[model samples]
Target chain A: MENIIELKNLRKVYRIGEEKVIALDDVSLSIKKGEFCCLLGTSGSGKSTMLNLMAGLEKPTKGTIRIKGQAIEKMSEKKLAKFRQEHLGFVFQSYNLLPMLTALENVSMPLTFKGLSKSVRDKKARDMLKAVGLETHIKHKPSQMSGGQQQRVGIARAFVAMPEIVFADEPTGNLDSRTTKEVMGLITEMARENNQTLVIVTHDLEIAGYADRIVHILDGNIEKIDIINARRVSNEEADNIISGADAVPAGV
Target chain B: MNKRDIIRLAFKNFMRRKTRSILTILGVLIGTSAIVVMLSLGIGMNESFRRQLSSMGSLNVIDVNPWYFIEDGRGGGYSGQNVLDDKAVAKIAAIEGVEAVTPFLQTGLRLVSGKYVMYANIMGVDPNALEAFGYKTAKGRMLTEDDTTALLFGSNTPYDFYNPRARNNYGGGYVYFGGYMGDGVERPEPDVDVLNDKLVLTFDFSYGERRPGGTGGSEGGNKKPKLYKVKGVGILEESQDERAYSIFMNIEYLKKIMKENERAQGSMGPRPGGSQQEGYSQVKVKVTDMNNVQKVQDQIKEMGYGAYSLTDVLKSMQETSATMQAVLGGIGAISLFVAAIGITNTMVMSIYERTREIGVMKVLGCMLGDIRNLFLIEAAIIGFFGGLLGLGFSYGASALLNRFAGGLFGGGYYYGPSQDSIVSLIPAWLALLALGFATLVGIISGFMPARRAMKLSALEAIKTE
Candidate 1:
């Protein structure tokens, strides 16, 4: 498979009142098209920093990042916004849906920035919500929904725009074991069904079990690259795991 | 994002904090109404001054006098250097903005009808220029150039007649009996009907009464002073103008009578003893518009003639009112400036609250310009609605002031052609200008806060609670 995202000698340093702290140092990685990839590490191990640098949310100190052969670092803010609108989707760990909007409105937000008609955006959002098992909570606000349900809506928003690359950062970090298993199943199933590149950053080993490959990080350095599962998870297998018909398994 | 979506999002954001937005808009509403009402009072004062002046005389008419008083060290004497003759009349007419120029000739004569007699001050004007001078008749037609012996009576001219032959004649004094009397009773009409009575004018002031040292018939055997049979052509409409108390006649006919009076008396006329009659003492110049009166008057003065118009009085009055308007407008503007500060504070507070929402939007690919536009539109909406409601309130306030404060000004009664007195006036252009100004203030107030929102770092903003 062709690489969809490439990082060469990536280095990120944070300065807090004159103290220089390295968040990511000399890290190189590649994410293949249609592959489910995970960056796994403990706290302060630079997994979240790697995700931020890759998403173009932060500028690297010294590095080059190419996503689908586009050098986003060289792009202006306006062009980068357009590029993100067309090609990328994000799922925040805290479920950063606007508190004022309902589930349907939240899901349709990304499409609104794309300038789609309200009818088209609403229709797509409705379909994505149904796919995420959130059809019953379409009109529920985040304040009214459970943490797990809000995270499900967040997942729906990430995929509703049909972006080529979806990045999830600890998407189920606030949920319980049972809800975490369901959210992880739903995210992997959606990525596989759409044949999209999925990148997730998490410290939980069980969440990393859903990815085809994992890159382990320690102290701002890549420790190893492990091939977890060569074949993509099938729809039936994902459904069984989410319904608890099959036992939760680890990536061996 | 498209314009519609941006507006929708902006509207939604504004409505999110309903109480805060309403309070901010209320501040703007009070500011706008304050400015409009204050300025309107100044306009109303100027309008009332114009009405009062117009009742006294035409604001567009300039009185051009040939004689100007020159103050020498000894005393002051009238200078007759600039002659207000036919050539000067033509020169003044040729100057820009002078609509009509006519020499005013005036002399006192005795009017007789049967046993009733009155000493009348008859003013002769160009027959063709009567209508242009804004003379309107209530009874008969104005004197035309063809009517040689025509006369136009003043509204009070008939009321001036008294029975000089009566035993208690009060020494031939005028009996006032024309207007509304005290205690709201209508006074009796005059005994003489000037428009229909057979009337004669003579140079004899003692036509029917006893003279101071001789009998009343004629002085020193003068042949009854040549009675000129003049027709009563018109009676002027009753007004507060002093011109309503004077009589009018054709200039040529009056000049012929003056020459006749001189010939009959075997002496010189009212002019200084010159072989030829001296030029008119004063000429009236009518300007096309009241605004042009000052310009025409200045040109006339430059020609060494003393020019005076009601616009002179009006200009002084307007200067005082303009100062009043400035002070009033400044007071109003201070309130609006405070309201602008209120808007800025509200927008700044809202930026703080919506930092996370803005970050999420930017991360979702919302344009930086769109974010700034959203904030600006929110502020402008507040200003527009406030201005609209404030204008409505200003009209209400104006009507209330005019209704209740009528007596202090003109008592809601105007004598000038078609206008009524008002104490507060708001024209259409002022309303529109206030709205535009309020909106501009809103935009200016929102600029800094919008820039702050635009430059907020998306990563840190989303990380904030």
Candidate 2:
């Protein structure tokens, strides 16, 4: 498998009242094509920052991020926006769909930026919604749908453009356990089917267990990397291990 | 990206806030309506004045009078001098804008019938030269080059006969031409037909032969006398006030009568006193255009003579109209300024409210130009519709004004050949110019807000809670 995303000594710093707080210090990672990798960390452990840097939404303070072998840290804002539109997709934890558009419209948004025809974009968006079991809820707005359904729509949107990489910031942060499993399952299944790399940031061990590999973060540094046989375990057995691991505090 | 999408998005955005859009458009409507109405009224007034002046004479006529030296610091006598000669008349005619010149010579004469003698002023005009100066014939034919020996009667003269006791009988017997042809008592209807009537004039000129008392002699002894036949009747439609009391005769006929009288008296040689009778009292020159009347008048004045033109009246009318238009335009501009402010406010508010939407579009790969164009198109749409509605309102208002003015003044106040009942008189070019100007105003008013919208940071906008 080819690496779709590569981070080299990535560092992010925030100035808080004249003090440089290192959000991510000397972080390095690689995400292979079609690989589901989760960045598991407690709050403020720089997980979201890492996701944002890989998604080309923010520039790294020091070091470089390459998406499909193209360095994004040196890219201009205009080029970055084009790069994001063409090669990167994002699902925010809050399910940040435009309130003005329906689930179908939200799914078609990235394709719109791709300059596709309306008919083609709409048809692709409809097909993605059907793949996510949301054909009946196509016209429902984000405010009208549940958190899990909205995340499902977000997942459909992220993959509708068939981008090389999909970066999700805590995909199941606002869902109940049942809905979390359902949404995470949908994201994993769709990303795998489309041969798209999925990079997820989450504090929930259950959500991290859904990824083939998980990288643990502590205080802006990678603490450990854990590989799970996600394809070998039944979904029920995977849920038991995920819920059993939740008994421990996230960082321990 | 394409025009269709841009227009569709702009339309959708505008339709989302209907009340605000309508109010903004209304502001523009008031501005455009004011401009249209003011300009229409100005045009109407100009046409009215032009029509009135045209009716007065050849808008091209210029009257020339003799210039005299002051005796006691006041212009007294003519000083027995002929300032404008036949050569000067010819020279004036040769001027670029001069169409014709008629040397007006007037002399007091007694017109006598049997017992009905009326004292009249005789004005001499060249029979061939009157037509170019806006003279029209209402009854008989106009004077011709060959008809130099006849007189032309004015239309306003009364010529009727009636019996004394039949005045109340309506239809009665009357005597015609000294013959008693009557049924009971007849009064002839007032003669509106006085074309080609004869008028006889008798005048006296003094040279060296004066009476023992040193006064000019009467027509009886050693005095000049003349008579001319009636040939043409001219209707002075424009100058009835000036021509009503006078009669027109061929200039050559008057010259021939003078010559014959001088020859019959055997005074062909130079007179003992050396006075010449070849000078005109006044000369009225007609120019080729009303616009050139003032220039020609000035040229004439440069020859050390006094001249006047209708331009003085025209100037005063133009000044009054300019003042009126300035006042009207000021009011209109003030309203337009208020409307512009309203547009600015609406745009600013829209920018503030749509910050997140702007961010979304930016992220969706909409260029900065596209965003600005969208706002400009929205503003232009408001201006376009406003201008259209304003034009309609101006049309209606001008029509009502024309009708009211016509009713009060006993004739249409607006002057034009058509005299259209609805005088919303904006010329086509002016309407186009108004619409264009309004659109420009809309664009300019939208500039600041569009810039602000363009400057919005996508990160801040999208991250805003």
Candidate 3:
């Protein structure tokens, strides 16, 4: 598969007063087209930082980031915003939908940035909401919707623009186990149907089971890269596969 | 986003905080109306002054007096040869902007008709120049060059004839008290209709009165001055002009009479070999336009003559009004300034409240310039609507002032008794300018807040609550 995203020697550091905190160090990774990849990590494991860096939300201290064969690391802020609108989508952990906007409006926002007319963007957003099973909640504001429902709207927004890559950062962090499975299934299913790349960052093993590959990150470093042959593995199978990969030497 | 969409978003955002936006617009309304009404009062004052002055005389007429001291420009001063003569009249007529010039030959005379006699200050003028001098008659017509003996009566001159013998009688010599009298007393016309009666003029003031030492006849030593039979050609329309009290005549006829009087008195007209310089003591010059009166008067003065025009008075009056306008407009601007501050405050508060929304829009690929334009358009909308409404209010205020504010000045000289006086005026151009100015104020007030919105970082703004 062709690689849609490539990162080499990526480093991120935070300066807190007199100390330098390294959030990410010497991270070399590539995400393939139509690949469902997961960065499984606990708190303070630099998974969120890696996601932000890869999305061009934050500049890295040292690295080169190539998305769809275009170097985006040194791009201007304006150019980066256009690049994000054209090729990238993000589903935040908090499901940051505007409280004043309805589900349809929230979903249509990304298409608005693409300068689509109101009628066209509204129709596209309506179709995306229906696909996410929130067609009946199109006019419902985020404050009026449940946490799981709002997450669905967020997922609808991320895919409505048909971006080349969609990044999900703990998209179901506030949802129950049942809702999490539904949102995760919906996101993976949509990405697979469109052959779009998906990157999920999460601390949950059950969430990692949906990915074709899982990269376990610890202490600002990639501890193991586990390739599962069968997609949508059971939680128990995902744990064994990741534990077996961790047993090998660091370079293997 | 397209411009139309941006404007729509701006309007929506402005309406989001309806109460605040309305209050801000109200402030602008008050400010705009205040300035407009205040400036209108100043304009009204000047208009009234112009009306009053024009009633007194032609504002464009310049009176040129002969200067005795003529500066030869070669150290010779006071030559006394720069009199307002025929040569000077021709020169003045040739000057740019001078429409017409006529020399005045004035003398006191008495008119006798029937038993009534009227003493009149007769002004002799070029027969052809009377119409250009703006003389309008209530009857007959102005003097023409073809008439050898002609007389034009002043509006009030016809009413001034009185019978000296009726002075001691109960119902006696009458003066028209402004064409009004007590109840049932009809306004009396002139006892002697000069236009129809056989009239004779003489330089003698006691022409029709009995002499003290002789019988009432043309006797020796008390002989009546040479009586010239003249016809009253016209009666002037009653006006505020001083000409309403002066009689007009052909200058050549008047000069011939003066010579006849001199001959009848058996006096030599001039010393032999002493040059008899013929000139007029005063000359009247009419300007083509009122605005050009000052320039024409200056040119006349440079020709070694003293010139005065009513435009000087108009200019001084205009200066006073301009000062008044500035002070009034300043007071109005202060309120507008306050309104501007209110707009800025409202925009800043709106920015603070919408910080998260701005960040989201920015992250969604809204241009920085678009965000700035949104706020500016919002502010401008407030100004535009306010200005439009303010102009409407100004018209209402103006109408009210004209209707009920009459005699507010206590009928002072500046506020004359003219029936159509305007107390407050707002010309169309002034209304338009006020609207544009108010809009500009709104744009200026919105500038700083818009810049702050544009400079806000997307990351930080999203992090804000």
Q: Quick one: best TM-score, which candidate?
A: 1
Report the number of the highest-DockQ candidate.
Answer: 1
Task: Please rank every candidate by lDDT, starting with the best.
Answer: 1, 3, 2
Q: What TM-score does chain B of candidate 2 reach?
A: 0.73
lDDT of 1 by residue, A1-252 (tens): 567899889998899898999888899887778989999999889888888777777778998999989886777888877878889888888888988788998999999888899999999999999999989999998999999999999999999999999999889889999999999999999999989999999999889888887889999999976665544332233434546633555344
Q: Assess candidate 3 and give its TM-score to the true structure.
A: 0.81
lDDT string, candidate 3, B1-465, tens digits = 667767777787778888998999999999999999999999988888787788778899999887645567998866344667889999999998888889888777888887778777788889898788888899988889977678998887887777766754213233453443224575567777878889988777776676787654356755457778889989998776668778889888877777777667666454221111556778999999998998898888789888887789989989998999999999999998998998999999999988877776776666677789989998888888888888899899988998888567322464335567767889989999999998999889999999999878776665412
Best-fitting candidate, measured by lDDT?
Answer: 1
Runs off by more than 4 Å, candidate 1: A133-139, A229-252, B68-81, B168-185, B211-220, B271-276, B403-421
Tell me how far the alpha carbon of residue B298 in candidate 2 is from the true structure, in angstroms, after superposition.
4.8
lDDT of 2: 0.69
Fnat of each prediction? Answer: 0.53, 0.10, 0.22
> Per-residue lDDT tens digits of candidate 1, residues B1-465?
778988887788888999998988888888999999999999998888887888778899999987665556688655656667888889999998878888888878889888888878788789888788888899889888798878898777777787787787743345453343234565467777787889989887788886688756656754667899988989998666656678888888888888877787775345322212567877899999888999998888778788898898989989998999999999999988988998899999999998988888888787889889989988887788778888888899999988877666542334422336678899999999999988888889999999999888888876623
DockQ-based class of model 3? acceptable
Output the lDDT of residue B70, model 2: 30
RMSD of 3: 6.0
Q: What interface root-mean-square deviation (Å) does model 3 yield?
A: 2.3
Off by more than 4 A, model 3: A33-40, A89-162, A166-170, A173-219, A226-252, B67-81, B125-153, B168-187, B192-205, B212-235, B249-278, B288-290, B386-411, B414-423
The Cα local distance difference test for each model comes to: 0.83, 0.69, 0.81
Q: Write the per-residue lDDT of candidate 2 for residues B254-329, one digit (tens) a residue.
A: 6666566557657565322121264565678888777888889877765545566667676788788778778877
